[model samples]
Target: MAEQQRLLGGRYLLKEKVGTGGMATVFRAQDQVLNRAVAVKIMLPQYAGDPTFAARFKQEAQAAAALQSPYIVGVYDWGKDGDTYYIVMELLHGTDLKSGVRSHGALDPKKVAQIGSQICGALSIAHKHEIIHRDIKPQNIMVQPDGNIKVMDFGIARAKNSHLTQDNNVLGTAHYVSPEQTRGQELGPTSDIYSLGVVMYECATGRVPFDGDDAISVALKQVNELPVPPSQINANVDGDLERIILKCMEKDPANRFQTADELRQVLNSYLAGRAVDVPEPTRVIAGMAGAGGTEAMRMGDKTQTMVRPTAPGDTASNPVIRPNNQINTSSYDNEKHGMGKGKIAAIAIAIVAFVAIAIFAVSGFLNGGDQKSVPNLLGMGQEAAVASIKSSGFEPGNVNQSYNDQYSEGQVCEQTPDGGKTAAAGSKIDIVISKGPKPIDQVEVPDLSNASDLDEAKKIIENAGLTVGSTTQEANDADEGKIVDQSPKAGEKVDKGSKVDIVVSSGPETDSVPGVVGKTESDATNTLSNAGFSVNVESGGTSDTYAKGYVMKQSPTGTAKKGSTVTIYISEGKDTSSDEVDVDSLGLTGMTAEDAEEAIANAGLKYDPRQQSSSSVEVGNVIKYSPGGKQPAGTVIILYISTGPSE
Candidate 1:
């Protein structure tokens, strides 16, 4: 049967293979139960049988499913059918970031920052959950049609508390792995930030920061080499963006942005046209193998022996035999020599002594006849130290460089054999050169003014290579729970791992608004105003319980912010339903139009004068009026006036 027709877990019907990776193959499939299309990732048969890989695969599904964000691909389901293990995820329609970058060269600096900000948002959520995305290469980022990105493939992400031995070997793509990851060191959110830095670098330069013929070579570079500034590769890259990217790629985790959110803030600030405060990128001292060379080997907790490949006509590949140390006298027969056993023993001893003396004389001649004291090369420059060793009758063996706090760079920090110690002439003396004191990692204090809450401020402070010193709450105009102040303020240069103190706002001061339901309007206003609240008065129509001009209702009857407005309603007295108007008082029959209007105005009723042709009454006179009965004040009164006789 064709692969597309095959069904897994009796629910996911495989359609077509969409992509393939080192550990699994992704297929666009239909989810029968949900009746929707999804991307199903099936573990390759080779890895599916391995218990460790299987467990990690399951973990990927669980971890990705737990994270819900627009920038993160959603995981729906995962299961095993027979020997096949598959995971179903939201199907996306966009090319991977790697493919896009390859098709189109380096992107605009602003575009790169925007993409980075989105990715950081996704990482911020994951890091908060204690999960580190071991792999963060362009291949795992999908650039959607709308220009937003969704991070995919949490296959190698390891939770902080995970016991899986999956990290026995480096897990991420070598070109983008962090230095600590290359050395198999413990990883945290910073490790992921390092990888993100590489991604942004690649996005800005159209190439990876490090590359070689093989993964090991690339991995070694990640640990030892400093990346060439992105601006060099792409001059369009601005200084601010380049520094942000390089900061992410710092060799030391302490030197890199401590948290994804911290990096995200910087990127967002750049995008928002705000000034960014990123320091210059760190430069790591070249390792023993020097920069950009594969000769250096990195060994982590596990011991590794690197064997050089044999070259043509290499003598080291061949084995050699050495003669036994003991003198052999099997060829000499005492009986044939016609000597007694005692005599033969003396002869043998004499021969052995003569040979020993001859050997000693030859060794003495080869070693310049005598022993000499090794020179005191300590504190001497490397070149001077080597020269001194030669002049002092000693040969310089191996010269190695190490970080020494007590010595300056290029000075000899230590030497084998003390200056007074005697060694045979021509013996090799080893020396260690100083590379200077290890550079103290420095980190900039992050601006905490934008922090929304104390917890967020703490994360920002800790992520910026500082510790939260203490937190105090103060009443202020700033919103409650917001960070209002900080110590050793942002933009200060401090040693990495320093402490920072912060202050949190408890919101504005407030006072109780006194109840004014039964008080007069003037008294109610005074009561509210004296309590530090501004008063606003409104009419409360006809309240029988409260007398006229008295407060009937009030808003915010309890505690309220000081200087805030308080609304009070004044009663308009009891209802006048019992009052009525007499019908005869209006008097409109046979009256003039002007006279009728005056009568309506006197009674507090509105006048509505209408014209009609009247033959029985005088012209321009009021002929009749309708509905002459009790009416409320402001009610319209309609009167028919004579418009002379109708034509």
Candidate 2:
């Protein structure tokens, strides 16, 4: 129960719970310092206590915080207080996609595409940073009151630099998982596209594509079954929209949209009523894996011939077609209708002659040909690798470059027919070069503490490639609207898009201690704290008017410095003749006469009660009392009770 009101980082005040999920509980909270409302998501105890889960949760939240996009839910702050880990995010007053669907089944196709497109926009940003949202489903998408979409829950997202998911332990909703995810294969942005496709399909058709009694069955269907098209479920679904959904749900990751940005472009085109280049539905041939599995209905009657490389260590005297006819090979039967003996001999002789020439050319034993083994070009710069290749009797062929996080830019990563392979002089060799780690902007933070104008300081910070974070107003000697202090201090090196908090001067603090008299001690302390003042509670002499535990007086009540300490005196009730009487004193002005008598008896005082007629007092309730101050432990005075209004 204490967790309900727990203050985190001395800033966020957790209020009533608003939501609960498998991983976290969300509460409506107040950012005390900012004096604004926020949503605080606290990890459940099970996850918070586990170091592995806690670290991953923190990393994901930090990654989300770094990403700034309108289509994505914003992460304000994240921190741990004692055993509880929490994340503060923008408090959205809208329903999740699931709730929307439940309330209004089968949304409009155009709206579905629009929502999917918005999510794709968010994904585009995340994917550019090499972050993949492993889980994308209706429940994780928030639909704002204004009909805008906000993609959420990157809790399972993993950066490209991190290792793959735990084998066989898929970390996503089964119904929306991609085939690769089900197979425990490597994942990329395409996986997210597939999940979004599922979401789009559900939004357009009022149900998930695959469903079963349990998660395992649903997962198997995701891996090995074709989903009924949205158009089939709901005839209102547009053909173009259905095509886009099918393309995103393609079984092979390679067949799906390569990037979220690509999907967004297609969606935009569809919304614009422009011609979209949607690929025709692919068919699953026998002994082949297609987007929708082997049993999927053929999209066309056209048969496609696919040539495959031989298996590793497959030994054969010659290429021969097996008789089961299970695989697609050459249609002609050369064995049944053989060539003449003279023709076969001639062909064999030609092959022998070619082999002899190739061997001799490589050995440089004939025709005065110079041949040498290729040099080790890997890890060398492109220019150096080319020079080495030329010096070793080989010419550098087409150079293919790709971004690599591990290799430096322009370094040779691979060479066809690799190093040490024998090649004739002046032979062309192809090499693959690294374009280096993806460029991430880093800049030195500009000093803004001395900036006199907040707007000007913000401009300067933006020029230095940083964003102005929350601005706090504090009382100081510096001019108002001027920066009094900053976080990541001036001259500190930080990420290019890092947010820096600044405190602006609101002028000298001339805070006056508020009147907390008659308030409970707890209420008084809270009042002082809210006023930017620290408070100390002290016991005050008993008062006849004030009740026990209530604030009677305070020190330095008129004017004091902001954040200055104040002492609040609490009432101990009326002073009594005996210590026992003081401890047993009771306030019975609001109590019924019977209740007052019972309290007096319990406090060891004699119960002397009498009835009185009064116009203002309620019937049988306490009206007046004698010896209002505490008396001897066994001493009692007259007690008057009202008997309705006087006649």
Candidate 3:
């Protein structure tokens, strides 16, 4: 339903719808408070009333808020007004990792490792917090234009300390779900690692590790089927890299990398061109959990957002509870609240009289107006305190941060009133937390198409809240220093501390060589130059025996090694003529053959060099002038001086 398009809490203005999910519709918005663009996710009417889903959604965004990494998306706000429940998140400006994989097809092995390593890094942070992301798929990951990978979507997951249900049979996306998820078994950090391995396989081969006619079929394969090695489909995939990917797809969760950190280290070694430690496959035993008494879950009234506690932190580990105050219980009922103010007000006034006179009293009655008690905000950050305080019955006062010795920085160190203390309605509460405030955003870096440039890639990673790790290189046509690969495989969801590997390209190689005989001179020179050959031209002989300018001969007919010089003989046209012959050598008509020979010799003409019989000259020299063939000047004219004979 379209309502007023007013700013959300006078901070973010909803602009346009961007996407839709199982329970929420996402919109693009302008954050008026931060003066930045942001994403706003609103719960659909269908899911808004679902207390379970709503709580999980809120928890997801809130939990994500505690992480700070370049490989995760940031959460800004989450709240409800009337039937509208919405969340504000960071707006990304680049294509998601799935987009990169689709556009580039299967990536090279080096590149897959580059991206996979980063994902492992991001997962480490969440693993450290005991948070297991049940859903780890390509669509949930992002690849920034600057070559960084960022993982997204943390709702419907659970933290170790959370009391959420683990008995439900909600399998993650069919393609990336681990075998345990399909079997409805207890999942751990390894579940996410397994899913990430599937993603890496997809990136390297351009296809997910498993596919079937339906979710069941796909899930069955995850549990029982072995995937073909990535290199079998993509020729560029390296053998060792393929092994790492297969290790990730082990049917048993225990066989897979136990933690994100474990995966990161192995991927690290792979990117470094070193051997990696492959984890043993996980083994499964059905019905491993013994039947025991479970903590009772109390269903609170619709008006109360808080659920009954399932026994506070296991005291053994939490010996240092803030002794000041902590109200772990504040149950509320609905029927009495529906009655008019008269009946409840009378009861509240009577209860108020019980307090000491020095303290101010609130007139609001037992109409259930004072059901919620403010949680002790000491040692909490201003933001955390504001959230806690506002959720309770009190307004958050001007929050100021200060240094504290007992508590960490930005933690709620102290509050105005202790927990369980009765206060007037709407009283502002002051709180201070430790100054060691941790960063709240974890943005997965974007998929960099290739080695764009080490520095450019680094900038993108840094912008995503990630740090750079080792870099590798090989030959490529790309510009020098351009990044050609990354780990995390683009779009693998992760938190902070993910180390992204960068692979750049060094240009092509150069050389020179020989071979030229059946080949022409141009062909020869070209060959030489190609093989790093040099050239020089020269004249051969006056015979012009070979065609002019043709390579009469090269110093070396073949084997023109690099830096070798070979001169070639070139034709310089005809070099002889018949102009010097004396045609008037008239010896007495046939006086004597000897005299005729002497006369022909005087004509600058020589006897036929190659012998042949001639009928005209009558055994003597003077043959009738029959200059049938005309040649250039200084030509040797054989006058058939009688001595010419057949060869």
Best candidate (score: lDDT): 1
TM-score of 3: 0.45
Lowest-sum lDDT 10-residue window in model 2: 309-318
Q: Which stretches of model 2 miss by more than 4 angstroms?
A: 163-168, 285-647
| Weakest ten-residue segment in model 1 by summed lDDT | 302-311
For model 1, the superposed segments whose C-alpha errors exceed 4 Å read: 284-647
Q: Say what the RMSD of model 2 is.
A: 23.1
> Which tens-of-lDDT digit does each residue in 177-242 have in candidate 1?
998888988888998999999999999999998999999999987877667778768878877898
Name every residue pair that clashes in candidate 2. Answer: 251-291
TM-score to native of every candidate shown: 0.46, 0.47, 0.45
How do all the candidates rank in terms of lDDT, highest first? 1, 2, 3
Q: In candidate 2, how many Å is residue 510 off? A: 30
Q: Which of 1 and 3 is ahead in TM-score?
A: 1
For candidate 2, write residues 447-518 as lDDT tens digits. 887676888899988999887654546668776788888876788777677767667887766777899999
Candidate 3, residues 304-375, lDDT tens digits: the string is 111111223222222433222222122222345666555476689877776743333343343346544558
| Cα-based lDDT at residue 24, candidate 3 | 83
